[model samples]
Target: MSAVASWPVVLSHGPVTLRPWRLTDRGAWDEIRRRNASWTGPWDSTRPHDSPEPPLTFAGMVRQFNRRARHGGMLPFAVDYRGPGERRGVLAGQLTISGITHGSAGWAQAGYWVDQRWAGRGIIPVALALASDYCFFTLRLHRMEVAIRPENARSLRVVEKLGFRYEGVRQRYMHVDGDWRDHAMFALHVEEVGPGLLARLEDQP
Candidate 1:
């Protein structure tokens, strides 16, 4: 099996940090979701009508992510941002590296969301760079992918800014916002960013 980081691994770049979720984070997480429900609902994935999987609560989701992490199939990160001179960090969002495949494939997908209040500050992009670097250097994954709904201009710009090469689209790729939706796929191979994605982000002109 390919290598994987232990559960609760933390990755950081400046004020943005990606760490595992805690049970105590439910309150803050719930508030963020509730407040941003309208903002994020359109892009959020949904269960199909015929699907057998039950809805997952915050605790249940955390447990599942942790269980998957043990087997090297998932990396669930809760994004935290600490402003300059701040002693403690506040929850900013979440980024999960899932769908990990080992051996020949050696690939994984990253998905993320940020609080509207914290959006456009380069936090999620930094978080993505950190996660991608960990997957490339630490876990030794070959490629990292990000799928975004076609209409999500904000998210689309993120991949563009981070230099993830456009890899076309998947028709009816995933159920989202009450129906199956096409997603624009973008990916970055380890070889494509030898200098590291984080450094590339910092070097943007």
Candidate 2:
């Protein structure tokens, strides 16, 4: 586990925050999933029709993420944006540091989704940069990876902007929508960030 036991409770940079999932987040999760259905469905992973567990349910999701965190194999976070809000934070989507491996590998993979309404606002890249920095600094991890389907231009743009070096293509990487999909992999080591990803973004106009 990371040195910080309270990891993922909340981490912020500018208007973006990556925090742990909460049971009370059910309403927002349901609403956003409904609104972003067509926008996000194509990229989302799917289970076979005969699968026993439901594809997604808020309570089940909360329990699943909490368990991963407890065993130190994952750090699942809900991404939020605070943009001129009247008060509380609003859920934009989610980001997860899953399949975390320690010891020799020291590796982890990041996965995320942003509400369609928030697209083109640079939320995913900034949030990812934040998460990666936390993993490198707080967790002392060696490598972080983000894999995106070849056709997902929006997501591809994110890693491009963040300067994640392209690795290669993975054939039939995972089940997406209703069939297997290929993905392009990108990765960055801790030493590459220099001053940090958030800092780099801030230096831009």
Candidate 3:
């Protein structure tokens, strides 16, 4: 019963848009990462010292994302925001739906990061809601989860605003900032957001 979309899918709401990452995005992505290195490093995932996975270049990363997307394993989106009077959107961040499982499992997890310049503007929540609705309705996934470092208060608020329930914590769950770090798990089921996640977000005061 697994459902996956064709590659290069795009989702949008108001000023925010989620689209496939492009090779041309290398420059902007690199610049943002450079400026925000200190801002995002503490919570960002890091390869374990003992692991054999090679580091990925920007092009390599985009290629891998596209390959996984074609295989229905992941949705790697480059977040864009089109502000007033701008002819085009600018890359503002990234949101990825990874670890998708079908059949009885029917679940997936989402992870995201925004440029420091875009933080505190509610863009991540919009991007998250768009992605979650796509999973719940279009992909027919049963559950969606977000794992956050307990210290990431900003990320915690995004899930709270969307009404995802706090499930529990996973100790030493993932390698982050050079070591295995604990994560507080939060989740939402399709039944819980009956209308749709995006709709729920819009209805929020």
Candidate 4:
């Protein structure tokens, strides 16, 4: 069974929601990525040196995400949440369940990014818990892994907040930003959270 088929198109918790990425999201993406280049570029992944062709167009990126969703390899989502009379759901960031595996593996990898403005608001941990719980319970995935660059303290804090067990450090695990970078890998098994990741996190005070 495909993981995407069993999941909600829009997953919500409190005022936060995670909906699949869309072609119409280009504007928001452009605005955020452009304005936050100094903040996000150091962590964003880049193509290999030998790869031909220019970077993907916004439309192409959306098409690729849609294709991945259909293939069951990923669920690309846009994180939306409400804030002090700021409208019901603002585009806050993105969270995705990528590299989904089924059959005997029954696992997936998670990746995310939040607008800097939303940092320290407890929005990320809540969003992550919601996704993690859905994967463990509804999708019946046995494990979920989150790998973060060692220097990405904010991201590491997120896994910690949710109590994802640290597995190990991966040396040059991925090509991030420009060069290969080491990452701290963390994971959670279905049994690790008896109640659910969201329930285990205990909403911030």
TM-score to native of every candidate shown:
0.97, 0.92, 0.97, 0.92
CA RMSD per model (angstroms): 1.4, 1.9, 1.3, 2.0
Q: Rate the local accuracy (lDDT) of all candidates.
A: 0.92, 0.85, 0.93, 0.84
Error of 3 at 141 (Å): 0.3
Which segments of model 3 are wrong by more than 4 Å? none
lDDT of 2 by residue, 64-150 (tens): 888878777888999989776546568998999998887899889999889988887889988998988877888888899998999
For residues 84-169, could you state the per-residue lDDT of candidate 3 as single tens digits? 78979999999999998888999999999999897888999999999999998889999999999999998999999999999999
Evaluate candidate 1 by giving its C-alpha RMSD to the native, one decimal: 1.4
Q: Pick the candidate with the highest TM-score.
A: 3
User: Per model, how many backbone clashes are there?
Assistant: 0, 0, 0, 0
What C-alpha lDDT does candidate 4 achieve relative to the native structure? 0.84
Q: How many clashing pairs does model 1 include?
A: 0
Order the candidates by TM-score, highest first. Answer: 3, 1, 4, 2
Model 2 residue pairs with clashes: none
Ordered from best to worst lDDT, the candidate numbers read: 3, 1, 2, 4
Greater-TM-score candidate between 2 and 3: 3
